[model samples]
Target: MANSPQSKKRARQAVRRNDVNKARRSRIRTYLRKVEEAIASGDKAVAQDALKNAQPELMRGVTKGVVHKNTAARKISRLAARVKALG
Candidate 1:
């Protein structure tokens, strides 16, 4: 419980930030899922396109502080490798 006015304000802000972050996370997951599905379908072209679209969104998540930079990098790296191996 926030006893002080400032703490209450912070609590409110945190709730708002949490909602935004949740949405961002969901969006990122959707993008990742698209790439996964494309890869799973064994279509290199579609997978490459999906990866192309997902990369910026992932990086955007990193920049917005919703995702860690290294985590995003690792994901991109792994996905790229999978797409490369799809040939």
Candidate 2:
């Protein structure tokens, strides 16, 4: 119910942004899942590499406003700990 032209434009922009954000979120989740699977497989080396790859993606999510800074930090911290414990 965007009656005003500005509102309609905003709605359109929001829809576009939503799609982009959704794609970014999905990609981030995929990276996180890779780390989880690597960890689950009990290969410390693979898990370490996966975590290394995922760290930047998670941080990118935070920078892109798809995730909070502390949330990204916590996830990276926990994943790093788990990977380390695989030793």
Candidate 3:
């Protein structure tokens, strides 16, 4: 639906950015899922390790604009609390 040449170029660029961002989002979700599964296993050590690994990945996603800072922080906080309560 982009008529002008510039608009078409912008649209194309947006498509590429969307694909990259989608991949980043998926990667972040996978990291989060790992932490969740580790927690569900009731192994504090494994859950802690998974949370350690996921923290940086989630922060990276924030910096890349794929995830919001507060959202990531809230998720980390909640997951940490759950992991702590596992004992």
**lDDT (C-alpha, whole model) for all candidates:** 0.99, 0.97, 0.97
lDDT of 2 by residue, 19-63 (tens): 999999999999999999999999999999999999999999999
Q: Which 10-residue window of candidate 1 scores lowest in summed lDDT?
A: 15-24
Clashing pairs in 1: none
User: Model 3, which residues run further than 4 Å from truth?
Assistant: none
lDDT score, candidate 1, position 6: 100
Summarize candidate 1's per-residue lDDT along 21-74 as a digit string, tens digits.
Answer: 999999999999999999999999999999999999999999999999999999
Clashes of each: 0, 0, 0
Leading candidate by TM-score: 2
If ranked by TM-score, best first, what sequence of candidates would result? 2, 1, 3
Could you tell me how far off, in angstroms, the CA of residue 13 lies in candidate 2 after the best superposition?
0.4
- Alpha-carbon runs more than 4 Å astray in model 1: none
CA deviation > 4 Å runs, candidate 2: none
TM-score of 3: 0.96
